[model samples]
Target chain A: MKQVLPKADTERAIDSVFAAARGRMPGAGLVPQIRARAFEVYERTGLPHRGMEDWKYTDLRALIGEVLPLAPRPNAEALVRAKVSAEQVSADQAVKLVLVDGVFAPELSDLGRLENEVVVRSLREVLENSATEAIAGLVLSTTNDSAISLNAAMATDGLVITVADGNAVKRPIQIVHVATGLSVSTFTRSYLQLGKGAHAAIVESFVPAEGASGYQANDAIIALVGDEASLSHIRVAADASDAVNISSAIIAVGARAKLDLFSMTCSGSISRYQGFITLAGEGTKLSANGVNLIRDKLRADTTIVVDHAGPHCTSREKFRAVVDDCGRSVFQGRIVVRPAARKTDATLTTRALLLSDQAEADNKPELKILADDVTCGHGATSGALDDTLVFYLRARGLSEKDAQMLLIKAFFGESIEEITSEKLRDFVTAQAEHWLQAGR
Target chain B: MALLEIRDLRVGVEDREVIRGLDLNVNAGEVHAIMGPNGSGKSTLSHVIAGKPGYEITGGQILFRGENLLRMEPNERAAKGVFLAFQYPIEIPGVTTMNFLRAALNAQRKARDQQEFSTPEFLKRVRDVADSLNIPQDMLKRGVNVGFSGGEKKRNEILQMALFEPSLCILDEIDSGLDIDALRIVASGINALRSPKRAMIVITHYRRLLDHIEPEIVHVMSKGRVMKSGGKELALELEACGYAQFEDAA
Candidate 1:
């Protein structure tokens, strides 16, 4: 019989977390048991490495070096300092939920200010109540992904939001994660459930507090859309240059439901965002799009998996990456059509613009089809700026830099146009423009 | 004073010399038609004047309004009133035609220290020019020259020429893919922009474009140099007598 070896470096880091979480792990009844089981799963697999097919391009073991200790629950004073101001995220009217260093900051949130018929609760508060099913549902997964397990074992607090049946929330929900000046690692998990025929839009921003450095954040969100429901999700990560951010979104779409997911990674020392989407019922539609503008020595990765399990469903995925200086960008997309899913239509396209000789881009698109009478395709391309287009713009009187900038913005215009909301589209475009300017 | 003076111009692409000892001069208000064969270096001459890359000016002097044109960048040449209507107009996706035009206009204005046009003023000007050129309203909203018909592209080039109002205009093979109707429309648009201060160079392999916008002088070119120079009737003579005789005369 083969004998198990001693613990690896990241495995020991997990052991330390497990030891530290002994009595402080928040949950009632089965919650602690679930957390322990999850930690066990992570302990067995350890941090994902280059050998894993899913993590082939982005090796966390190699990139993360050694895991920093889990962030402690913020003290009152530290919470105050870590709270992200409303003006810092957006001036648009939104239902704000604030999390400071992985702990719920009620004083910084707009709980009572919400006018819509929406239910919002803190995950920790719900974990202690008889909401055992809700807690279990939040952590339940078809696959025991190591990252999700790690988040479950260590997450201190997050939000639990629900839009009741037939409810259409007028204001978007804004969940802002703020890390204070302390260089600490944090884990957070959230759940969003929409009842039948419900509609809502949520914007999640990962922002480090002013002067914060060397922080690491692991976040996960589980969203379930019921029949005829619609959800718009936008995630933007602008962490500190020395920070590492890992985020995941697991979404399930019901019959005739719609999901629009858009993400942008404009700043981070190293960041990876994974989106797992499953069309569970017939006639559902989804559009998954993203943009990454990275510069300097930063690295960004966008990995998406779209599963079409329902008949007559459709999905479209588009991503654009712009790398400057010594930055690196990676995009991996997989679209799977199950046997029961017929007449499924899916398409994916990813393009990268490398602005410097040292910049790098890796794009991988895969499709697995088991159903007949389905249409699915994907394409990827990476190259330096188009010299002909630059010359064309220059011949019309634009400077070289200005011409390159114009082409870069134009390259991202397609993905931006997919956004349904005008204000959000403009905001994202402005964010892209800001990234471009910072690199210059 | 000459608007453009080319003295002993020699240009090469990579290793081979395309334009060998070419010389031509055009005064303000005069239109010069350069009739050439496929490899006569007419297009190379236009690109060199517009300051395109990938070309070595081995030995030449290209003077535009008394400035060394070769010393300027492409955008600088454009701001200084040199325009080239390319034989193949590049299709730029995701850049609306209106936006492209506005950016170009404003950049040129900024370089010349002129006040930029207001949005409404700019819109009105573009609409007027677009309407005059029979450009559909939808075309202005789409990407520049993306999915445009061949004739539409040629007309768009002429529309740009009208808008920039450059002092020296070089139209390189502008009539290659144009039908009779398109050729007539493009030529009329060029004729509308003709002024005493604006000189024009029409480079073509055929004489059809010269019918509508007649030139004051015509030069038969071969082997990178002008083999013969005559009046506007020179084009008709070349049409009657092919460039075979002049091909070796250079």
Candidate 2:
């Protein structure tokens, strides 16, 4: 294997990662070859900079600064001490899967009582056994996206979940990722395949273990929903304050399939959550919503792209960002309808609230419709809280802080109420309240 | 001492003077009505008294129970037994009425060095007050004034007044959007809270509301200062004679 000396810090960081993972990296046959190809692509592009349209608001080159070597695989002691945080927003009946430091931990996971129609396997195990055709192809191998390419090149371990046709999972499945060590970089890639007519709900959470700091985590999740399948996906990233988290979700919806995706980001010094969704068949429905509660020097970015390729599909995207103190928040949503996709109904709305004078919020909603008969619209709003409303509450006897708090809660109340799951809604609400109370 | 004393008060909104040299005195047991044509600084007086922001008191003294009222913030005034029923109550979409009231009540209590009410005790008190004001329980459960009718918002304002039990209450244009039935209900709600230890300043444009909740003093204001001070019959006399004469007087 020829070693490629790279120039940029992000690229040099990748070379070091490849050097460190010598022969122990997962995968065999086409998997290793695919990883090498991904590395080649990543080396060619380096890290996405400020010029890239998709990376405009989130400049990884500048934001990431210097990427460290891949986190040495968690040791037995580290795994033993790692526990899912108490912020699990799942019901008691949920089937939980735990990933420590980007590696699937079977001891922490409960797979014994999984439904007969569902099959869950470790991604690394599947890759090492040459049984990677289905999982490998199911994953969206981004050729140009440097982040996902880097994720693929350094992918450590994650889950491969398959739901059989027409089987509805009675309990929700939670994939909780707990970062246990400090000053380490972790990459995880997961693939979920839902057969025709299958229905399931999956929750993914990223939270660092107690006192962990300066961890960099990159995660890519690819899901393929078959025709008539319904999937509810919720992702929450509550990392340590000094952590850098970059998460991406790539979903493909088939004919008549429904995808309800929601994400909430609460802590993290620098974070970006992006979603790439495609409605491929007719009669598909997509609702993608997000809420970000960020304070201090945190910079949170949420970008979503919904591609409507089939006629008569409906899609709605809503995002709310609350930036406090010196925090900066960004929301970018784009809905694209192809020329043949007539009768498409797509609406995108993004709103941001700036809490302090130094706080900043940037919202951009775009619509590209080549179909003449399609109904597509986008709206964006960014401003400070209404002074009159604050005065109204204060005049009613609420203190200044309490008045502001009440208005902030009400601002997020409408969007949080849109969550389909009761427990998840409560969890998001509590996280938002936590952010509100974390003031300057 | 008078409950409220406004001595030659001068107030301005932005670059224009709104309330110029306004003087009024209200005893502990008095209901005063200030009426005039549009833009007569009636709302200005109410807002300045309640300490709403954006008002510059260039000259004057406003003393509440012998304490300088201008030095207090809006919430400080509220905690110090002052309430203002906004003519156009702002709709807060997320904070439920129940939550708002409890927080308000507890804030006042806390400022007064009183123990906060427990959840059950607060709910019982709110239910009792809400029942008397004809406020449905579900309305209290919903967001404050969100999607409320015009009359419902007015009633909610009165409900806040009832719950807070302020010593000096200022109702600004409280009769603007009420129908006959809602007016009667609101008037009775105000009448129920009237006591010798409390005073109210009702700013209205019509004589109908004055008829339901009769005022002890009526002052005709024009431009900024009061042009005439008389009894409750003055409201009816002004209603018949119109405020053209007062507008000229200013």
Candidate 3:
């Protein structure tokens, strides 16, 4: 006889939340069925645990002892708090889309200037109208990870952006998720589609309102780049100090398409960023990189899976982490080349700088190649800053603290330079410097 | 009082004594040279003076301008006008040479309670010094010592020495990898910074560098201690015959 174990507290809580929120969840036709199927998967698997291979370093079952209740709809007070927090993370000269407590706030968003070249619709409206095939296929068909499943079952509202064929959006579109409630959870899902020959850039920022802490944020983005199109996506996770943030990105590149993705993580007590990218068409190019600054007993993990399903594709992944004062950082990268992906060129490299004796860093790189004609390589390193370098800087009249900060900045600067937009690069660099300045 | 003083300097690394009871002194406006073979503690002496970590100071007293220099941190010593030109300058990728120089200069100035240099002022100062040392503007734009040739690295040391205007300059094997042309250029840069209020302690294994920058006093070291002391003529003699006599004496 098979033994049946009791569910964890978080699993039960999540089950109850799903039972209560199933009917209220937006979407018409098969959307409700899809949501129920997703929740069933989560219930069967429970929260991701160390027993699973993918979640070896990040065990949500053990880390998240209890799950908080879903955040309520944002009231007027919450709107004001969201505005204050959104202003701190919003980029200059970019179209802003604001989401308060996982619910899209149209009043706080500025999409009027982009109405012509870009079509913007609320996910809730799209789901309610039953015109959700695109979103459903994008979110449900990509991966079966329990976190993604849980997000699909609970997502309240997000943006659906599409660029017309051959159109070029000059300014970047910024998505700002502001958490204004403490000790609650919020879920959001967004989708972006670029038509053939279109070019655009997107920036996603996750921040917390002043005085907000101990919150949980689950967000996901599904992006598609059409043939001959180019897209640049930058995500910044700067949540509250004690918050738990889990975000995922699913991206697909079409024939001859180019995608550049970069993410920076500097806040939150516990955070994990999962990226699933696929080369869906021939001759696609992808550049994915990330930087993590973990300090003060915090834990941050970045896992990326790149699938080269088409021939003559290229992918490069570079990640850097600076861990200090008992902080832990994890980087797991996997590259898969199908049999048809001949002439595929892929490489991954991750490095971590540990500042204290108690700091920890785990780097795992995996390559699964089924093609005979492929060039693939990966390298990972974890260690403290070079003593000689520190001594040299100190000998040059810089204090010990200043010397370390400069070296740390230099460590992250390499990956930040991959950003094509000079303004965005500068903005990211300044934010990194600000994080370093706010010492542990 | 002497500008720099050392008494009974005994240094060790991992329980191995490297400098045993060494004594040295230098007054302002003087150039002193310490020449030695490999493992003779010449470089160790320079490192000890610069306050590099990992070397245990078993017994020593280093004084600069009537103050106990050993009590200060490396940066504090740097701010107080003590500079050591490394034998091998570190290569720091992703940090531009211009930014590094600015940070170093401003840090020292801030420690001394002086105003930090404005962008234009800093640029002008760096340009003047770099021009004198034959360093191109493009090199300044690149990472410090990244892909720099041996000559360029030595010349960069001289450029920094000129910029900081330190009172006590310790050149630790600055001529190790330079050709005769590079030696001349670097030596000329060093000569340009010579002032009556400043002093230099040049450490080398060969006498070729002394030909360009003459020193008033030369000390021959062997087995972690000074075996003999003499004038400029001693360097010429040592060049004629190697440190065989000094090693035998030790």
- Compared with the true structure, model 1 gives a TM-score of 0.97
Q: Clash pairs of candidate 2?
A: A410-B94
Worst 10 residues of 1 chain B by lDDT: B241-250
* Residue-by-residue lDDT tens digits, candidate 1, B114-197: 999999999898888889999988998999999999999998898888888899999999998988998888889999988999
Over A196-266, each residue of candidate 3 has an lDDT whose tens digit, in order, gives: 99999999999998778899998988888899999999999999879999999998889999999999999
Expressed as tens digits, the lDDT of each residue in A340-420 for candidate 1 is 999999999999989899999999999999999999999999998888889878888898888988999998877877989
Off by over 4 Å in 1: A1-6, A22-24, A75-86, A139-142
Comparing 1 and 3 on TM-score, the stronger one: 1
Q: Which ten residues in a row have the lowest lDDT in candidate 3 chain B?
A: B156-165
How does residue A311 of candidate 2 score in lDDT? 92
What is each predicted model's overall lDDT from 0 to 1?
0.87, 0.86, 0.90
| lDDT score, candidate 3 | 0.90
True contacts kept of 2: 0.91
Model 2, CA-based lDDT: 0.86
Interface RMSD list for the candidates: 0.8, 0.9, 0.5
- Identify the leading candidate in terms of lDDT: 3
On the 0 to 100 scale, the lDDT of residue A4 in model 1 is 57
What is the lDDT for A278 in model 3?
Answer: 90
